[model samples]
Target chain A: MRDVYIIGAGIHPFGRHDLSGLEQGVAAARDALKDAGADWQDMQFAFGGSLAAGNADAMLPIMGLSTMQFINVANGCATGGSALLSGYWSIKSEEFDMGIVVGFDKHPRGAFNADPKASGLPQWYGDQGLMLTTQFFGMKIQRYKELYGISDETLGKVAEKAFQNGSLTPHAWRREPVDLDTIMNSQMVSDPLTKFMFCSPAEGGAALILASEEKMKQLGAKGVLMRGASVRTRPQGSFEVFSPSLDVERGGTPTEVASKAVYEMAGIGPEEIDIAQIQDTESGAEIMHMSENGFCADGDQEKLIQDGDTKIGGKLPINTDGGCLACGEPIGASGLRQVYENVIQLRGDAGDRQVPGNPRLGYTQVYGAPGLSACTILSAA
Target chain B: MAELLDKEEILKLEPLAEGLFRLDNGVPVLLGGKNKETGKIVFPMPSGAEAERFDVVPLKRTGKLWSWTVQRFRPKTPPYRGPGDDKNFQPYAVGYVELEDQVIVETRIMGDPDQTLKIGMEMELALEPFELGDEDKYVSTFAFKPVA
Candidate 1:
């Protein structure tokens, strides 16, 4: 029940990196510690998230810190969020006063080659061409469009916003703003979605420093209160990947369940959130997630985009530092990158893409493969 | 029948029904379990370990298309065992078929990818053959085809 606050956050940008995954982790971790004016010895615990690396905790050696409890976490795209949660719980339970959470990844090219057997899924599932994550996003949004009358232009607008924001961001991968027509004219990756709308596999690292309220006061550092942190999986009957068949009368998706839990724990509804960083593996994902995260109605994304409500300097600026759409999706670092952006926005450090108002409350949600979702609420202290 | 033919010969692989579909009077019908307590239905219901009280029942043969997407490109290897090389891979439609509001089966849509597939259109299950490897190795899979 103790309070947790994020004292510092850092990122190694989102794009191809020549350094190894652990190297990237070490870089981000070092920056985070420096930003907090703390040393490696101050960290009582550490959690690392990475998909392509051997073990994120291995970065401990590089930091010259040892004998500390370090756990490596991997939950697909939720890796970063899960790591942050682990660090938060470590402090919340009074088990540790302060900790570091780092997520980094170095991925290969082309569509992610997921292993069904490795993930405990039947070989037949992939053999029948059912395990591709791209197909899942495409199908999910296709259904959303059918039920809600969303159009390709609306989806294109989402990508355009992300790229435009990325262009202004210092560390974004795709820094050039793409035109709406260019996004729409891009080659088809799936029906209703073009190649330009999909996020590419990326290489990057992001890290956060979480400490108790007492510890922050000791350091005399300003920080953001970690009001809520939650992670949830799909309940039965929800339309999720790896689900061969769905119960028509099933339960809620991980995003819905996790968002609700996070809001309840934070003691704030979606209306209080001034900025957001959500999962946008593809353009349509942003559109669908806008509703899933309770930001808007189920079918109101077209208006949300057209009115520029979800853009920077608008009603609710989402992914102001560019999302996975513009940053590229480095599975492990993706979630923490969202938090890093929130921290920057809350601190009023984001120069170009800062929301017009002095945003006080921010929220982040990350959805992973095989149905796992996590969200965290941050408020300026 | 197990002792009768060459391994390379084409064979009707067991349907991917997992006891959910059967050839009843030469017609394929989906099967499911209706929970006695909750009245909830599940297709290809769990066997033995969790089937203490539910009855295995036959599901409706046809339903409407709920949602769909097309695989515009070939998926990666080590998992995808579809026919042909990536260069020759043809786009295919994938969708969910709602079976009488009881269950929605995720299935491959058997139709031309260029054709427009509207939601709420009637669809029926069809057992189809999927060739694997260079030889005659094949597997029988199930897909939902639009019903006239």
Candidate 2:
């Protein structure tokens, strides 16, 4: 099988814009093309990722760019990462030399967006309640803090450091520095989780171009060959409807399952990872992710983050881009955004946010819709 | 969306088995009536691992405030017309109750239509109906009451 690597990564500043989803897709795709210094004309196939917009790929690419045909795919929050997985499968099969995956999202208009998994009737008909996505995680957050005694400050530490780093990055959704007090004082969304502990909804786009080893040599692909690209759904046997146990239900807890598979597939272990990007829609999800993915044992994550172990200079740099908590949560684009950060870290182009010394393996976790989860592993090694 | 029917006439708020409808693994299901329009919560069923008995009382007590909403405008469907001249029940209140055993239940609240409900409130189940009706084929339903 021909080795595949991400040759170019691109994304639009993930914030609200007047442009439509299709326009965002085009802009993001162009950014990837520019980063790779390759023309869209050279593309063999494409996978356009968008969560809500209908049939977005057909309208994104510049017309007559090698007449390259593209396929559209969506996996809810995992849309972009799953798109990356699909692109990898096709490229490694030698059907396509290069593929591009792009995802775009803007928060819903009017009433809070309804959760499709709610099992209840339509919001227009049933009193489903106004569920702020981040706040909806309130139940689990309350339990986790109670179980672990993780102070609000430890959660804030990530916010204080991450958003500051995001502020420096041109593409981050939130660019403001936040202190622990600021985070604690933020409006209460759910018990124990204030507004700052939640990710703000924003508009953004993320695009990545992947090429097979054969194509990379032809295009002079530099740095960070795709050591591992994996996207997975929760095990069918394990998937359940409305598990009352808060621990089992939050964001699908797939980091454990995915990490086990990814490590075996990437031939790497958690200890080998220099940097990791966890999906932290709410501050609590971040810590739970640390435990579920074997980054730390239960309750140990508090010490890990409070002691600065997950920070850039700590034992492992997690969410060097401030996470969704500090960064905006642009649903469709958020998953790919994780990949974008990993790419930048592996490429050593993370600027001031870059970790000390050259890092090697990077892990990205995208857990969502309460149980739909996927993890991608990238290595510059 | 069905019409907001006379919930009292349609639902029979009887205990399915007087807390007998327990999970095979010994988990008990809470049953009761929560006023869909009044936002009142009532628990009418027994919970927890209790032995079968005559005149049985409930053993379970904890529940999570799952989700909630005030009845905005008239309900989409039902025989529910508020106590006004207009036929449309323009505003009411209602939501779901998730108990400790992870049972999601429906309930109603008595409040101004403009009042908002916070998710995860400490709500207990109650026996009541959002819509009242005269003597007919009387059916019953459950409701919820906010625990102080």
Candidate 3:
């Protein structure tokens, strides 16, 4: 296998947008190519994904009719991570010297409504109003809090920090800082979780240009080394979304599996990671993923958040760009947004929200429905 | 038994979906599927061609609340056939009830919204009116309530 580097990254601001999903995607792609000091024809291949947008390969006509392999990826919230991974593999395997990986999505306002029959679940599950993603997150955290003794205040703090960071992020959707009291007092969407703690379904696009070491040097472009990337699915007995039944015996989560594999692939432990961006679909998810990703022990988030350890300039900064909570989840684009934020952070170009002290290593994790998780590790080159 | 049927008839009762629950000696019992090879049990027993590989079995009526949440707003329709508007919709508790030595079934918890429910509390299966069906009958779905 060969080394892959991210020469450039770009993102269309996340939130409601007038442009179509494909147009947003193309804009990001063009910016990425420009940032890399390369042109559209320079990409030897492309990989992209979108949940609500049309096929990614369809961008060929709009992006100059270049005949390059463009594979479409669709892996729930891991769409962007998977696309990046595909591009990484193409370069690692020497199949392609350089390529573009992009993701974009525009969902209608409101909670995403899924078809039970399409997911192979009984229709009654949906009819009885039991098939909801919010309810699943609520129950999962409710149980975790009971077992781990996590406090409601800790949950509120997570959202408060997200908004605080979002205030500094130009690309973030929720740019205003929210107080802890306000977050805790917001309308209850599900028991123990309020409206302010949840990320709304919104629009956006992000793209990354990956190249081999040879290609990067040839273009005289600075780059970030793609150390590792891994995607894992739920194992049997693991609790996941949209389940009508759960096994009596609990099992490991996909985040745990993917995190473990990614650390091994990157040849580093979580402690060495200077800046991190794990999935924060809600406050509880960030708390849970903190332990799942091997950053901290279960129930330790309370102390970490209270001590401001996870905040910018702290020991281990997380979601310096506000994560899903502030950005609003665009499904396909959300994962790549993490990488884009990390790239800027690594380059020391994240204007106001930059993590103080030169950070060398950055990590990102994205998780979604049916219990899937994707993790990536990047290092400044 | 007759009183139960009278109450059902007054509401124009119908199961939300066929074969989910049935009356056994005047008591409603939820049906589950027991895998022939693995002995793994699943709720609402598999239907159609998939049903061929498992034996239909009655699930335990009593269990303990594993985890729960409340639906504070109306879910989107097409999948959700319940009350569409906020005026007609009432917040309801949803939970996973762990049946000892069997599967943990996701279910609606029948109770007052203001009443707080504790984890590991004993719960028992019951039938609740879900929504109005096409035939003017009230569709009944299975739910769990705190055991008296």
| DockQ values, each candidate | 0.56, 0.07, 0.81
TM-score per candidate = 0.92, 0.74, 0.97
Comparison by DockQ, 1 against 3, better one: 3
**Model 2, A1-381: lDDT tens per residue?**
777788899888876688876677777888988887777778787877676656656554353546666777777777777788888888878888887778877775322454423533222112222233433355555556666677778777767767777777778768888778888887554555676777777777888888877677788867466666666566532322232212212344456777787778788778888898888877878887888777777888778887888878888988988878666777778888888888898888999788877888888888876466678788883
Task: Give the per-residue lDDT digits (tens) of candidate 1, residues A304-366.
Answer: 899999999889998898899999988999999999999989999999888877899999999
The deviation in Å at residue A199 for candidate 3 is: 0.1
DockQ of candidate 1 compared with the true complex: 0.56
User: Which model scores highest in lDDT?
Assistant: 3
lDDT of 3 by residue, B40-137 (tens): 99987999899998999999999999999999988877688776476677788999999999999999998675577889999999877665433444
TM-score of 3: 0.97
What TM value does model 2 have?
Answer: 0.74
Off by over 4 Å in 2: A60-65, A109-111, A115-132, A235-252, B1-124, B128-148
* Residue runs of model 3 more than 4 Å from their true location after superposition: B1-12, B133-136
| Positional deviation of residue A100's Cα in model 1 after best superposition, in angstroms | 0.8
What overall lDDT goes with each candidate model? 0.85, 0.64, 0.91
Note the residue pairs that clash in candidate 3.
Answer: none
